[model samples]
Target chain A: MLADIEEFYRLDRLPHIWCPGCGNGIVLACLVKAIKELKYDQDKTVVVSGIGCSSRASAYLDFNTLHTTHGRALAFATGIKLAKPELNIFVITGDGDSSAIGGNHLIHAARRNIDLNVVIFNNNIYGMTGGQYSPLTPKVQKATTAPYGTIERPFDLAKLVEAAGATYVARSTAYHTRLTTELIINGAKNKGFSVTEVISQCPVSYGRRNRFNTPAAMLEWQREMAVPVIKARSMAPEELEGKIITGELYRGHAPEYVSEYTKLTQRLKEEAEGV
Target chain B: MPKDPANIGKPEVAIKDSWCKGCGICVALCPKKVLVMNAQGKAVVACPEKCVGCKMCAEHCPDYAITVEVE
Candidate 1:
């Protein structure tokens, strides 16, 4: 409805290349709005992503952006954060890009507790690569590779990152757009590593392969499956079966890697001068 | 120019036609039934007066095509 245009978006890329019902656009909007609400200096903020459907978000965002190689977005982002800790870095990675080929980078980054805001677009399948089953693909969810359905259990990325040492972690769906934005805002505010895993829909890749006839149906499924963190606590484990627990899953204090590295260098500099 | 007559004093729910992909997300998610997909499939405000300015349609629009101003 913006008559002029969203200042945060690249005018040349007015209409994004995402599929008609793909939730990538919604997640991208959430990320940008979160950045706006935080009043971050656009010039100081950097958006990075690896190759995939969701990674294309960097092309539309009007900021210091990077389109890195496959599954290595976190590695590139970590290097950037180390080089220029003052700039706000946001990684826009897909489930496959973050959890499959780049899985090791994901764990190490969370383990380091670096000050980077990561937003994983968990669309389940490897959409850009033509519907291959990714690591986060829910168990028994059909993909092109898994003609019937995936047999392996999917990783609960929020729990994975929390255990790996992320200071803040949250999971939200594209249907819950406002909640996704709010989680990103809080995650960005966290001092250490923050992960906001958005359960975005891949209507073309994941839906058609499965039984979700329309994107609306998938959205409704998300609505039915999502249970807030506060509400989930009271329900018994059995009652939570098949329900996705969303909201702030974890928030803890930790020594940020960047600051610790800076401290080490400063101490060495003082010691050298004293000698 | 074909604004619904009932929209006289309603909060504006403006939608950019060019950007809309007709995903129907805004229409389905609009709790007030204030939006509908026109014949061409772009979303239009059917009853702007019912808009509580929650921005459900605006915020959830995948194409970033909807906007609402309560004031």
Candidate 2:
């Protein structure tokens, strides 16, 4: 089986460091499947990630992977993309890594509409740093920091990115493996900034505290909570509450950052030559 | 016993216990219910005959613990 998809991963780095029942692997597999289906040039594709369990995926993929500082995967990826516009850049980040520390970068990147595929592994807590509640953690969810249940509302990451001007925005959970892969593939193929928020499971860190003691239970929760975007359209707001809307939520075209920059450079060169 | 042509050289689900964390994603996702967790919690192919080589288990296994191969 490994032989079938050997080119997509660095098998030598197998036995990944993620804890048992962690959904990061499922997201990773989906991403690999999407890349394979798209037939992207392996040599020209770069996987960038920030500090977190999900970020560790950069090391496992056999692409031009970059493990950047905490909350700075997009920042690093921005530079990489500007320098080499031909490369396909995919940024892998976690909830805490992206929504909290890297919140500003995420917004700016989306606003710029850069040609970057961003996948957020939203496990609701900081799994790598000990189950702390993240910006995406639900209002009543228990976390190390929120022992008595969180008081603040969680960030709707897909909506946030869409509002921030991302060309593509979608959401999916680990249980919806096929949907996740399809959304990711579409996100990757989008011309401008694309964000796919994968509501992953942190069984050990998140589940034990939230009564979802096993990966299967957490996934089942995801299955129950996820409603397709089209189906969700017919449901009332009240009925849609607490349910994740999965599928392509939005897709719109805009001038990608790299191409805009190139045009600017050409214009400036023409002006200089005229002078 | 005469073997059906469709059943001849059928694929078998292989379990790599050392890598399997017994998450049961494969068990839940198996369309044919060909797998079940044993006493040790690791997934085992309970009915290989039911396996249609959909490879859903292989594709979704987080641990890369299950693989389907034709003998």
Candidate 3:
């Protein structure tokens, strides 16, 4: 199926830093497959990431990559898009990198409807920092920081991005590889800010601390929790509790930021020249 | 590539042990149950004859450890 995995990666960086059975590889594979299917120009594509285990993806991919400061991937990506509107940009960020400290940037990016694809690798806990409870960590979940349990509720990533006015929003788990790849392709094709929240597994950091001690168990848990968006529609909210509603959650046409800026600058120049 | 006599006319499933984390996903997802984790915690072909070249294990493997070749 995906025969060209090596083509999308920097072979010198082989043997990624993620632990065995980590779902980050699966998400990366889906991303590579989506890029292949889209036949995007690698020279014109930029992969940006924030500080985290997931952010390490920028180093592995063979693209014009930018590994930015912690929780500032979208902000950096915004500058890149505004400077060079023709570039295809993809921001790979973790739950904590996006929703915790970068929450304001994420929401504002969606509000501005910038044409950039954002894929949030939501593994619940901050795996790179040794299992700190993140904004998307489910309530009552045990983390290194919250050994007893987390008291705060988690952010519904898809709903948050959708409410913030992203043109395309979708959710899928690492267990659903095909769906995740397809959703990423669709998100890249969308004209405005698109967020695809992939519920990934962090076996070493999150699983070891929680009851899911193995990668298989963590993946099985995701498999059991995921419900297709269409099927979830027929079920009541109470019945659908604790289920991951996967598939495209929202899609709307909007004015993309970079294009609007280009138009504004062109009109200003024309008025100045008295054309 | 010349076919090995041992696997001549048979589908070959190769597992890169170095990359495999012994997650058992390939074993669990294999429709024919042709794969299983060995004592060393690496996936091994349990029933190579039953393998239909479906590549489910290869597709689902998080480590990219499994590859299927069908003649």
Candidate 4:
């Protein structure tokens, strides 16, 4: 098993930290494969993360990474890209980190249409600080904090990003490893801000409390909820209601953050010269 | 001959002793012989050089204690 892992993974760093059956490790594998396939300059690529189990992604990759403050990976990444526009920036964040405390930053980053790739690991709970309810946790899902079941409705990450003006928005799950990796790789290649919300499983916290007894059972739930975007659109609102739509939801041409900022710099230079 | 000499480096693993309940599952599951129990019986990296970051400890930890941080 380890031999197979070493062939594609960083073998020296064996025995990862993710709990048994946790989906974060799978997501990490997908990300690493995507990076390798793209063959991007490791020196020019930066992986930024906030506090959470998923945030550990920054430390694992052999690239320029920034482990920033909670809910602030986007802010730090924005500054980094604005300072050095040539770098390829990737943000790895968990559901709680991106949508709850960092919700404002997430929407604003998309609205600005920055040239950053964001991978949202939506496990529906706060796995690091104990299993607590997250913004993406479905209504009535039980969490450590919501022992009686969560009453509040959940946030639709893809719709939120699309409405915020993200140039590309897609959804995938750890269950769909190949497709998830493809979405991440394509998101990286997209010029304007691209976001992929990966609805993953947190067996220890999210699953155990929500009545998912085993990892396999939890994965089955994801499979059931996911509906292809094309099929979903053809169905009426009644038919599509309650179904989780997966695939590329929205893609449009938009000016990247760097190009827009470049125009600003050129204008400033011309004004200074005239003065 | 050394197999890709430049590829050799330190082993990596995500250690969260606080999350470890000393269940010893990781010790039993890791095929690389990488994890070991410390004085308190919590899982620790004993032969990390043998580790391949296969994520066995993380995927198996019932407590969500560890997350592999590779470099």
Q: Pick by DockQ: which candidate is best?
A: 1
Model 1 chain A: lowest-lDDT 10 consecutive positions: A1-10
**lDDT (Cα, tens digit) per residue for candidate 1, span A122-223:** 999999879999999889989999998999999888888988999999999988988998999999999889999999899999999899987787888998
lDDT of 3 by residue, A1-275 (tens): 23557788886776677887888888888888888888899999999999999999999899999999999999999999999988999999999999998999999999999999999999998998888999998988889989998999999989898899899999999988889999999999999999999999988878887888678788889999999999999999998888999999999888999989999999999999996
List-wise, what DockQ does each model earn? 0.58, 0.52, 0.49, 0.07
The deviation in Å at residue A11 for candidate 3 is 1.3
The alpha-carbon interface RMSD of model 3 comes to 2.5
Rank candidates by lDDT, best first.
Answer: 2, 1, 3, 4
lDDT of 4 by residue, A32-84 (tens): 66777787787888899998999976766667889999999999999999999
Tens digits of per-residue lDDT, candidate 2, B10-69, equal 987788888888888888878899999999988998998999888878876777777887
Q: Deviation in angstroms for A266 in model 3?
A: 0.6
Clashes of each: 1, 0, 0, 19
What's the residue-level lDDT of B24 in candidate 2? Answer: 84
Candidate 2: TM-score of chain A is 0.98
lDDT of 2 at A256: 92
Candidate 2 residue-wise lDDT, A5-59, digit = tens? 6688888888688887889988898888888988999999999999999999999
C-alpha lDDT of candidate 4 relative to the true structure: 0.80
- Which run of 10 residues does model 2 chain A get worst, by summed lDDT? A1-10
Each model's fraction of native contacts: 0.61, 0.47, 0.37, 0.04
